[model samples]
Structure formats: C-alpha cells, structure tokens
Target: MKTLINFAVILFFAIAFNGIAYSNDECSFNGIDDVLYFQENSISNLREITVEACVKVNSFSARKSGANEIWQFIIFKKNQLDHFNEGFAIYLDEKNERFATSVASAKGIQAVIVDKKHSVELGRWYRLRMSANSKEIKFFVDGVLVKSAPTGFPLDFDSEELFIGGRTKILKDKDFEGRFCGSIKNIKIWSKVLDEDD
Candidate 1:
C-alpha cells in the first residue's frame, strides 16, 4: 500500500507542473505585417498594449477603433515629433474627434523612459495600472509607476482598426500623430481598477 501511495504522489506532481505551464498563455501580436489588435471586446484591464511591428505589447488596454478604446496612457511632450521622438500614441478615425486628455506626473517626473520619453525604452518593460470607475492613469517602468495622469483628459472613445507603434493617419487629424518604434510586452486587462489596495 505504501508503494501504491508513492506512485500516486508522483503522478499528481506531474499533472500540477503541466497545469502551471498551461496557465501562462498571454495575448500577443508581433511583426511588420501585423496591424492592430485588442484583447478584450469591452473596456477592461487584465493588461493591454499598443505597440508597433517587430515589437511586443504588454498592455492593460484593449486595442480598439475609437478613442480611449485602448489602455495605453500616452505621453506627448510636444505637438509635432520626429519618428525617433514618436512615443506611444493612439487615435480615432471615425466620427468622434477628441484629443488632449489630462494626466499627472509621478516618481521624479522622469522623461520618456522605457523607450526614450516617447518611444518604448529598449529592452525595458512598462505597466499601466488604473481603476474601472476612476480616471487614474499610472505609468510603470519595469513594474514601477514613474508617471501618471489624473482624470478628465482626451477621454475614451469607441472605434476599431487601431494602430500601434504609432497612430493612424486619422489620429493625426486629432493631433496624436507619430509612428512609435520599439519593443513592447505584458498587456494586462483588469475587470476593475487595480492598485496597491486591490
């Protein structure tokens, strides 16, 4: 009976290990040909991302067609920018034309980090955390909140055919123009706002 129990224990261990590995299936969209993608159909945060081709997107926002459809908390220090200066951006090309949302700075008010202030910091990771009901945008670098936007900004919209690694031409019409270049990862989407408390 002891030997039988030992065999059962080993079998259970094998099953458990496989289960852990299976749970690690995060959403992904990479390559030059790649265009757009949104993890959730509605506004939620498990983690969402908006990035370019040949890059990885780890975002809590879902890629969508309208404004604020994505979970990307963009930072625009200036109006016009060179490709190299083009940081993370998004826009809506349809009916709703909105731009310039409100955001706050945090942790030393660091310049475009994770990419270069605007672009995704090379070989770096970023996390965007927020609440469901509140308009709190927190930017995290390597799992740290370096900057943030309070609330009542450009405001979220409804659209699809979204763009990553840069904004679509229509976005330019709204004033958010720039094709971002770099790598991205870890798109988390949550049902409600997740912070130190939750």
Candidate 2:
C-alpha cells in the first residue's frame, strides 16, 4: 500500500514535469484560438496565474491598428512598458508589435501602458488568452471574447526566448524595467491552431 502511494506521487510529478496532456475531464488547450493562456485567482478573484509561466512572446493576434487595439491580459515583463518600446504584446499591429485596439478604447481601456506597476479589478481573478490564427489575431478575457486584431495581419514572429509575464526585446530596444506583480497558473501552449470551442 505504501509503495502504491509513492508510485502515484511519483507519476503525478513526472507527468507535470513532462507537460503531459490534461485529462478530458480537465480543460484542454484550445487549438482553434491558437493563443497563450494565463489565469489567476488572486488578482481577479477567479484564478491566479504566475507571470513567470510565459516570458517570451513575439507573435500574437489582437490584430488592431490606430489608437485602439485589442487587450489580451498577459504576464509580460513589468519594465517592458516603461519606455513603451515593445513588451509582450496582445494585439499586434504589423509583424510583432502589439498595439492598442479599438475594442479597449470603446470600453474605455487603454489596453497598453508603459509603467513599473499596473492593476486591474484586484481580487476579480482573471483569465487571459491570445493567439494568432489564419484569419487574424484573437484575445480573450476571463474566457469571454474581448477583441480581435485588424484584418490582414502578417503571421510572423521574430523572437524565440518565450517567458511568462515577460516580453522579448527584439522588435525594439525595450526591456522589462519593472517587477512583474501578479499570479499566474495553468499554462498550456501548443504550436498548432486552436479552435474557438477549444
């Protein structure tokens, strides 16, 4: 009996360490969306996802242009926004630049801010996801569709080193200048497209 318990514990750790697929009973990665997933309960009162889970992201579809762009909650480098060069972006503009979408503007949200610290509805627990598909880039907040990027967005990513809550400094000379402050969890990623229902 003791051996059985030990085996079970070892198996659990092994699977987790190897990034095993989740059981059908649990949430699976959505391929149609083809986006990054980050959830946190402490920050939004739902689930808490650590920012360290996703550090490097170059290509995302929030495909928007102009003063307003899509806003996908991501755990990017905190200091990346200090100079507003290019930190982990949700709604990309052309190649790999994340821009503010109109949806955020219409909702009265800037969607993009360069600072050492920022907070939203603390204790609400939020789930943020973003991805790039054949059509356009997409973004979701709390599992609810928030916005999409402008049509005809190029599907090209330049960065490679991906980090949770941190963005790469490839497109621009900007780096994270602030300490990422948030909870991140349940990180699942794939190199394929995700379905809407996924």
Candidate 3:
C-alpha cells in the first residue's frame, strides 16, 4: 500500500514538471536560423503594434554593404527585403556600436538609432521592446526607454510575417553578413500600442 502511494505522488510531480517545461518551450527560439512565421490571419493589422522579446546576443555582424547592420528581429512584408515598403526592424549596428530601430513605410523610413556609446554587450540577456502607432514610436531596452520619435505613417500589415533571431533572406542564403548569432525567447506581440507601464 505504501509503495502505491509513493508511486502516485511521483507521477503527479512528473506531470506537473512536464507542464511547466512545455510552457517555457512555447516561447523560446534557439539557433541562428530560428524563426516564427505567422499566417496572415493569425495576427491582426499592424497599424498599432507592440513587440517584446528577451534576447541574448551571441554575436553581431555587419551586412554585405557594411553600411546597414543585421536585424535581429523583424516584422516584414513577404518577398520585400531591402526596399520594404512597410515593416519594422531592430538591429545591432556594429560600425557605430549601438542598437537601432527602423520603421519603414511608403512615406519614408523613420529610424531611431541610439548613439554609438550605448552599444549592447554580447552574451548578455536584455529585454527589448518596441511600440508604435500613428502618433509615435518608442524603443526600450531592459525596461528603460532608449529612443523615441514621431511616427506619422502607419505600418503596412498586408501579408506580413515575423522573423526572429535573424533576417529571412540571410537564413536562406547562408549569408553571415546580416545574420544574427543569438538566442531569443519570451516573444510577445500585441495589436495595440502598449503603454510604458505595460
């Protein structure tokens, strides 16, 4: 009788532990080629959006031109790479040694690049958040606001997909120029602009 009771207790604990592990696994992204693509209907329009993720920068490299940096995370229109008419990207600028964010639209590209001195260190985990609406756009690192700017044009969400850990083309092309070497987890997306307190 005692053995039966002990066996039941162990089984209960095992099931509980497995549930916790599975929950964590749902949000984690590992490897240089890790990406999560969303179906068009899976996500709502991107007019006002918030993207948050916990990232550990394993490495950083400049793109082919060496002028534009590699984006670590991007919400982009399919098949539109360099001249994306509607999209947003967060990247590490090796040349300037700073973290940067860019929001592009048919109107123009509005970039909020941190100064060279505010570069993020490698092999450290940091919470990166970006919120945008028609009025403005904001970037945050480690729960602190790093950059903010006015945003007049709304993001185009038609046929959009989310790219994590690295850009889409770089993953397929095996191009190290704009590839991200890192681990990303706990990615959350919202259809509405999130407040500072959120």
| Highest TM-score against the true fold, candidate | 3
The 0-to-1 C-alpha lDDT of every candidate, in the order given, reads: 0.29, 0.31, 0.54
TM-scores for all candidates: the values are 0.37, 0.39, 0.68
Q: Give candidate 2's error at residue 51 in angstroms.
A: 13
**Cα error, candidate 1, residue 82 (Å):** 22
lDDT of 2 by residue, 151-196 (tens): 2322322123333322322222233222122334444443333433
TM-score order, best first, reads 3, 2, 1
Model 3 vs truth, CA RMSD: 10.3
Greater TM-score among 1 and 2 belongs to 2
Which 10 residues in a row give candidate 1 its minimum summed lDDT? Answer: 1-10
Kindly list the per-residue Cα lDDT of model 3 for residues 22-133, writing each as its tens digit: 2332233333434444344434355777777676665555233232343444333322334553366666665555566666665555645453464678777877777877
User: Could you report the Cα RMSD, in angstroms, for every candidate shown?
Assistant: 15.1, 15.4, 10.3
**lDDT score at residue 138, model 2, on the 0-100 scale:** 56
lDDT of each residue in 47-138, candidate 1, tens digit only: 22222112233332323333333223232221122222222232211112211222222212212222232344333434433221234444
Better of 1 and 3 by TM-score: 3
What is candidate 3's TM-score against the reference?
A: 0.68
Off by over 4 Å in 2: 1-73, 76-119, 168-178
When 2 and 3 are scored with lDDT, the better candidate is 3
Give the number of the best model, judged by lDDT: 3
